[model samples]
Target: MAFVRVAALSQLPEGGALGVEAAGRRIAVARVDGEVYAFADNCSHRDFPLSHGEVDAAARTITCEWHGAAFCLLTGEPTCAPAFRPIAIYPAKVEDGAVWVEIADEPAPAEKAGGLRSLGI
Candidate 1:
C-alpha cells in the first residue's frame, strides 16, 4: 500500500468534501480548519455518497443528506442516526500542493484484528 495522489489541494474547497477514487475504493476527502481528512464516501446506513452532504467545519462533522446521518471527520464515527456504524477512515495528507491518500493492499492492521464493523469502525 502506498500514498496515491487523488486531487490537487487547490481543487478541494475549504469546509467541504470531495469524492475521489483511490485503489478502486470510493473515498471522501474533506478539508476542515486547514486540515484534511479522508474516509469512505458511502454512508454506513445507506448507499449515499458522503461527499454529497454538508460539512460542519467548526463541529468537524459531515452530514449525510439522504438520511441526516452525521459522522465525525477525524474519526469517521457516526455522530447522529440513522447511522450507528462508523465509516472507514484512511490516512491522508497534503504535500506538494496535492492531496494524497494511503490505500492499503489488504485489510488494515486494525481491521485484521477485529474487522471494521466488529471494532465499531
Candidate 2:
C-alpha cells in the first residue's frame, strides 16, 4: 500500500468536505467531529459528485444534490433509497498535520477471477 497526501487537517472544516484528485481518482475528504473520512467523490445513485452536496454533520451523512440520495460518511453506505450501491471507501490517516490515504495495490489476475475481474487489474 502507498500513502498519498491529499490535504492538511486544517484544510477541511467541520461539517465540510473537499474534493481532491490523486492517482487519477476523484476523492472526497470530509471532516466531522474532529475526525476525517475519505470516499470516492461520485455518488452511487447517479454518478454525481458528492463533494458538491451537503454534509449533515449531526447525522454523519452526505446528501447528493442531484438526486437526494444520502450516504453515511463513516462507512460510505447508502442510508436512503435509490442508492443501493455503496461508494468505495479509502483508509485515511493523519501524519505531520497532513492527511494521507492508503491506496491498495492492483490485484493479481487470480485474485480477481470472479466478477471482480472487471476491476481491470
Candidate 3:
C-alpha cells in the first residue's frame, strides 16, 4: 500500500467529513481537531455514506444520519448501536497542506475471475 493524495487540507473543515475516490474505492476522510482520518465511506449498518454524518472532534466520532450509528474516527469501530462491524481504516497524513491516505491495492474483479489476461499465453 502507498499513500495517495486525496484532498487539500484547507478543503476539509474542522469536524467535517468528506467522501472521495481512491484506489478505485470510496474513502471517507474526516477532520478532527486539526488531524485527518480516513476510512471506508460506507456505513456497516445500511451502506449509507458516512460523509453525510455529523462529526464530533472531541469524541472522535462520526454519527451516521441515516440510522444514528456513531463510529470512532480514529479506530473505525462502532461507538453506538445499529452497527457492530468496524469500517476499514487507512493511515492518513498531511503533507504541505495536502491530505494523503494509504490504501491497499486490490485486484480487479476480472483479474480475480480469471479473465483473458489470466490465460497462460
Candidate 4:
C-alpha cells in the first residue's frame, strides 16, 4: 500500500473526525490527541457511514450513530455490539501539514473471507 494525500492536517481539529475519499476508497480519518487514525467509513453493523458517528478521544474509539456500534480508532476493531465484526483500518499520518492515508493495492480487508457484513448499504 502507498500513502496518498487525503486532506490538510489543519482540516482535522483535535478530537475531530473527517470522511475522505482517497485511492478509490471511503476512509474515515480521526485526530485524537494530535495523532491521526484512519479506517473504513462504513459501520460494521449497518453499512452506515461511521464518519457520521461520534469520536471519543479518551476511549480512542469511534461510535456508529445508527446502532451504537463502536470501533477502535487505531485498529478498527469493534468494541461494542450490533457490530461483532471489525472494519478495515488504514495507516495514516500527518506529513508536511497534510493528512496521508495508505490504501492497500489489493482489496480492502473488510471484503475478504471472514469479513463482517451489515444489513446492506
Candidate 5:
C-alpha cells in the first residue's frame, strides 16, 4: 500500500467531509469529533457522489443527497433502503497535520469480490 497525501487536517472541519482523488479513485474523507474516516466517494445506490451528501456526526452516517440512501461512516455499511450494498472503504491516517490515504498499488477487488463483474470492467 502507498500512502498518498490528500489534504491538510486543518482544511477539513469536524462533522464535514472532503472529496479527493488519488490514483484515479475518488475518496470521501470525513472528520467526526476529531476522528477521520475514508470511503469511496460514490454511493452504492445510484452512483452519486457521497461528498455531495450530508454527514451525520452523532449517527456516524452519510446520507446520499440524491436518493436518500444512508451509510455508516465508520464502516461504510448501508443502513437504509435503496442501497443494500456497502460502499468501498479505505484506510486513512493523519500525520504532521496532514491526511494520508493508503491506496493499494493495484486496485483491489470491490467490496464484494465478484460483485463488480456486472459493471463489465
Candidate 6:
C-alpha cells in the first residue's frame, strides 16, 4: 500500500467529507480542526456513501445521512444505532497542500470484516 494524492486540501470543506477512489476502493476523506482523516466511504449499515454524510468536528464523528448512523473518524467505530459495525479507516495525511491516503489493492482482511444490517432506529 502507498499514499496517493486524492484531493487538494483547499477543496475539502473545513468540516466535511469528500468521496474519492483510491486503489479502486471508495474512500472518504474528511477534515477536522485542521487535521485530516480517511475511512471507507460506504456506510456499514446501508452501504451508502459516507462522504455524503455529515461530519461533527467536535465529536470527531461522521453521520450517515441515509440512516443517521455515526462513526468515529479516528477509530471508525460505530457511535450509535442503525449501524453496529465499524468502518475501515485508512492512513491519511496532508502534505504539499494535498490529501493523501494510504490505500491497498485490497482492503486489509480486518477492514473486510464489516457487516451490513438495517436495524431501524
**lDDT of all predictions, in order shown?**
0.83, 0.76, 0.80, 0.85, 0.81, 0.87
- Candidate 3 residue lDDT tens string, 1-121: 7999999998898889999998887788999877899887877777788899999888999998888989898777789887777777788999999999987786433223332121221
Q: Is candidate 2 or candidate 3 better by TM-score?
A: 3
Candidate number achieving the greatest TM-score relative to the actual structure: 4
Better of 2 and 3 by lDDT: 3
Over 4 Å off in model 1, which ranges? 108-121
- Backbone clashes in each candidate structure, one number apiece? 0, 0, 0, 0, 0, 0
lDDT of 1: 0.83
Q: Against the hidden reference, what TM-scores do the models get?
A: 0.87, 0.82, 0.85, 0.92, 0.87, 0.91
Q: Report the candidate with higher lDDT, 1 versus 5.
A: 1
Worst 10 residues of 2 by lDDT: 112-121
Residue runs of model 6 more than 4 Å from their true location after superposition? 116-121
lDDT of 3: 0.80
Error of 4 at 2 (Å): 0.9
Per-residue lDDT for 21-50 in model 5, tens only? Answer: 988888889988888888888887767788
Residues 1-121 of candidate 1 have per-residue lDDT tens digits of 8999999999899998899987877888999887999988888776588999999988999999888989988787889878777788889999999999998998554334332332233
Model 4: ten consecutive residues of lowest lDDT: 112-121
Top lDDT model: 6
When sorted by lDDT, best at the front, the candidate numbers are 6, 4, 1, 5, 3, 2
Per-residue accuracy of model 4 over 1-121 as CA lDDT, tens digit each? 7999999999988888889998777788999988999988888887788888899988999999898989998777889888888899888889999999988888677756334467453
- When superposed on Cα atoms, how far off is each prediction in RMSD? 3.6, 5.2, 8.5, 1.9, 3.1, 2.1
Off by over 4 Å in 2: 107-121
